[model samples]
Target: MPEAHIARTGPRILVFSTNPISDPGIDLVGSAHMRYQPGVVTIPVPCSSGIRPSWLLHAIEAGFDGVFIAADGGDCAFVPDCTTRTAKIVDTAQKLLTEHGHDPQRIKMAAICSVCAEPFVNHMEKFSAALEALEV
Candidate 1:
């Protein structure tokens, strides 16, 4: 089988978003005509708390420059402790990144609400900048 190809012109970021919450906010960025880095890609999951640390590491190994977790925070309807659980996932992923000689800063997490189009764009911009700086 041929290897999958992703042509990236700049820092490539993979974002994990909660389907019920942050996914809508990320979608709003496009609907509202807000622009972010072309390399930013998002995959919606049922809940942020369900994300596996191994998946985050796999993204880095698969050529992503960074990974961002758009956590549901206090607004999660699926898990009452979603924020805390997601934070632990970040911590574990960072530790694994460090163990494998990768920069732990490549992972970031933040709360993005359903109506946070502008904020989502802002986060993407900031994350892109941060990833670029890491390469320097």
Candidate 2:
């Protein structure tokens, strides 16, 4: 997949990752170079499941188009019947945003592994698409 490009005037995105995200996640280095543009930032988090609602809200209020959360869920997978906390938190946050008239799609989460580059990139693409669909 090609790197996702955001026009200079477009709303930016803050990607909060719950696991390691490598450079190869993007299709090319040239595209990767554009990452620091006004519209994109990648932040590493301990776990996507544990991200707080307050943090998400802060980003939204700061003019970010959206927040994309990706987590290495192998831990959760190994612990069956343990509905992970991060998943629940993200869902709760989405609901809260909707109640306030904001498009809940602004907050998104995906279960992914660092080594599985394609799925991770796909999630980012989907998140970007959703943000694009928002009417601001």
Candidate 3:
């Protein structure tokens, strides 16, 4: 029996959180990414929107597969426009990546509310699968 091989393509996913990982009540997400730690590296940012263009470019230059910005939505306790701007940059960056002949799928954006962890995990899986398809 031949097992299908999965090529690990795409920049290793970096999940940028607008809130600190140390914050309480962040968990409620059991099966959400708790099963296996794949290529995802989580970095807690002040605000997902605060990520600069240079930083994103630096990440790509550093050999990252891709960067995924997931910001706080619904009730934005910190800044109202933070996640909005993050979404904007994500769109802008994807276009830039496509312009450079790179797979624009390298960048992604998602808004996570209190109960959206499961969906978040789902997106991660889908993104990873899409990356795999791109390799084919």
Q: What is the Cα-based lDDT of residue 109 in candidate 3?
A: 75
Q: Which predicted model would earn the best lDDT?
A: 1
The full ranking of all candidates by lDDT, starting with the best, is: 1, 3, 2
Q: lDDT of each prediction vs. the true structure?
A: 0.93, 0.63, 0.65
Clashing pairs in 3: 10-65, 11-64, 11-65, 11-66, 12-65
lDDT of 1 by residue, 1-136 (tens): 4576666588999999988999999999889888888888999998999999999999999999999999999999988998999999999999999999899999999999998899888898898899999999
Q: For residues 27-77, could you state the per-residue lDDT of candidate 3 as single tens digits?
A: 435534453236777777666667775566566667777777777654566
Q: Give one digit per residue, the lDDT tens place, for model 2 in 23-89.
A: 2343232354433234667777655555787777778877888876665455443344323666777
Q: Give the TM-scores of the predictions, in the order they appear.
A: 0.93, 0.69, 0.73
Ranking by TM-score: 1, 3, 2
RMSD of 1: 3.6
Better of 1 and 3 by lDDT: 1
lDDT of 2: 0.63
Sum up the clashes in candidate 1.
0
Candidate 3 ranges beyond 4 A from true positions = 1-11, 20-33
What's the lDDT of the predicted structure labeled candidate 1?
0.93
